[model samples]
Target: MFIDEAEIEVFAGRGGSGCLSFHREKFVPKGGPDGGDGGKGGDVVFVGDENLHTLMDSKYKKHYRAKNGSPGEGSNKTGKNGENAEIAVPLGTIFREDGKVIGEILSHGERFAAAAGGKGGRGNARFKSPTNRAPREFETGREGEKKLLKLELKLLADVGLVGFPNAGKSTLISVLSSAKPKIADYPFTTLIPNLGIVDCFNYRSFVIADIPGLIEGAHTGKGLGIQFIKHIERTSMLLFLIDMTEQNPKKAFDVLKGELKKFNPEILEKPMLIVLTKTDIDPDAKFPKRIGGIPVYPISSISRTGLEELKHYCCETVLRNN
Candidate 1:
């Protein structure tokens, strides 16, 4: 399962306490006070790992904690420090604490401290003075820090493919890249977003993401709803595909536009390419030169019709924009 969101709690270790003792080595006179200082606590840290893409591991286990420090010993001996705890998450994951964003992990091996450990206490040996010799006093340790946090993951792709169910978007992605996504003749075959790397002319490469299909009332929670839309929010460009067998390509595009606009108005302003798929099934379908001032392309993944032109066009457009 592709779990994009999850909640967790982190706690740091507590500091150790101080110890006090009096020296009695059978000397001629009385001995002074001798005490040891306490050790410091551990910290809770979060790390980014590129191998992971989901927060499913955090879903089952919610809490993470560090170890507590040991107490101090007599004869000026300090306690052992606590061990630190490390949590690994995928890159492009955002961290939030109490509904406010703390920071985001954009690359692998990135580290962030979620909680800080408490400081150690003072020993009684340092409290000795000329006026009050052999005086005994010890301080207690401080408590550790704790926090509840939320994590959200966003996809990073150069191009995002958007269309209704059974529009041949998955088939096109399979042919374009080496990503092997499950394809079927029915609707909603893709439950999660799939990413693939497409290399174009002159060793130029880009990442593409194919999200779940959207329906007419997608913005209102119909047919995968906002879940699919959020996956494509970070794409540099969008490729909108329409089935060639459909009666009205303009209406299909309009519905997609309305849904995207309703969810996020900024999405409508991004550069987009209008394309018709499944040309092999309907060879006689009329191909329009332009729609709403945007160019149109008709392609067939099975027959590799117009596929090269489409790839080169996307590469050129993305390179120009970037």
Candidate 2:
């Protein structure tokens, strides 16, 4: 039910037309022209709601429209303005126009105007002058602008856990944070992204996102990895977890790195922490450390081993980057 992308159409309300009428008085025989200007239309807006984590609501409903303004009255009264339409979406959502990012919503209550209302028409009352006693012409209202917008949700997390299936990435996230994701020994257990808030001392907090696992050709859509790879774009940091108990940890790490690189070169530039998961299988194997100069932390999420070190490391990295 966690939808990340959606396409929607938004239409602004049209302005009301002007009204022209002759003023009649009880005492006077004749009266000047009494015309009223039309009211302006309403706008279509989008607001970011932090309480929402998915774009599922927008999936079924793709079209949004505002109400039109009322026409002018005969008593020189202007019409009522149109009602505005507001659509709520998850935070960290980005609006695109023709595949290009036009706006981004990162905080709650943040709003963006998707379409502008049309302008109201002018009345004919101003035409009265010395040379021209009365003018019967009136202008019509202009139409509102319509737009097709594409919205994409990129989860905002302080830490993004990335690895292959059964790599204990989910276990690490669940143990480190308050998230309780479905855990199994089989591959591709996590099909969607799981978010959890990690609380530290002094009320410090951060969001961790655990997405589906990656495969060798993940970048080529061989698995669900490519589809969710964009979720890592907005993460402040990455936790690359590898199952060191496997025969070759280096090869696994390389495949994960290669997939990231293939999907987006910028992913390689992100701050990463290599974590060797399930160290309970082989306590003394520093298999992850042999990868290179990258920071490596060997920990067993199930046994609660080296958890403090990993937490401290993640927190320190986040703070340093901030």
Candidate 3:
């Protein structure tokens, strides 16, 4: 399952209490306080794992907690600290608390401390003084931190495919890379984002992301909505794919651009290319030389027409931008 979002509660371990014992020996004349300090609690941490692609584990397990520290023992012996609880999540996962961004893990083996452990308490021996040698005062351990956090995962890719339903996005990616995404003639065949690593000449390659199709009201929760749109926010470039079979290609391009602009205007600032797909279906069909000042490339994934040129161009553009 491709679960991108999840909510979880984290609880840090509590510290142990201090011991209030007094020294008792057979030969010692004056036995002073011999209490030991408590051990510190454990923290809750989140680790980034590149191998993980979904937040399914976090979704199923909504709560997490660290081990608590042991209490202090007699004979000036301190308690053992609790073990930390580490939760592994996919890279590019963002943590939020109360609608505010807290932290994010973007690299493999990276860790983020979600909740902090409590401090240990002071032992009775620490209160010993000249006037009060037999001090009995001891401190209690502090409580650990608790948090309700939200996790959001965004796919990391070099290029993002932006298009409406049945625009041949999946078909292009399948031919360019080893990624095999479910493709059908119907709309909304791709319910989740698919990634493919397109290899260019000289062993150079770039990752491409194909998200769910967008519609005119995609920014307003229509069709697949903005759920999959955010996955492309981190992309270095955008590829606008249009179906040549559409009656009004210009209107389709405008609508796709408008939806992206409404969701996030910065997306328009990225390097982009306009691709008209299904050229083999209508070889004699005419298209604009340029759309919104961007060059257009018409290709047919079925017949592999113009695939090499498109692949080379995409690779060079992505490599240069990087």
Q: For model 2, give the 10-residue run with minimal summed lDDT.
A: 284-293
**TM-scores for candidates 1 onward, in order:** 0.59, 0.59, 0.61
Q: For candidate 3, give the lDDT.
A: 0.88
The model with the greater lDDT, 2 or 3, is 3
Residues 178-269 of candidate 2: C-alpha lDDT, one tens digit per residue: 77999999999999888877876677777788999998998778877487776666677998888877677778878898998887788888
The top-ranked prediction according to TM-score is: 3
RMSD of each: 10.9, 10.5, 9.9
lDDT leaderboard ranking: 3, 1, 2
Better of 1 and 3 by lDDT: 3
What is the clash count of model 1?
0
Better by lDDT, candidate 2 or 1? 1
- Write the residue-wise lDDT of candidate 3 on 8-101 in tens digits: 9999999888889898899997788988888888999999897898999998999999988777767888888888999999988989999998
Model 1 per-residue lDDT at 236: 71
Off-target runs (Cα >4 Å) in candidate 2 are 1-10, 13-91, 94-155, 288-290
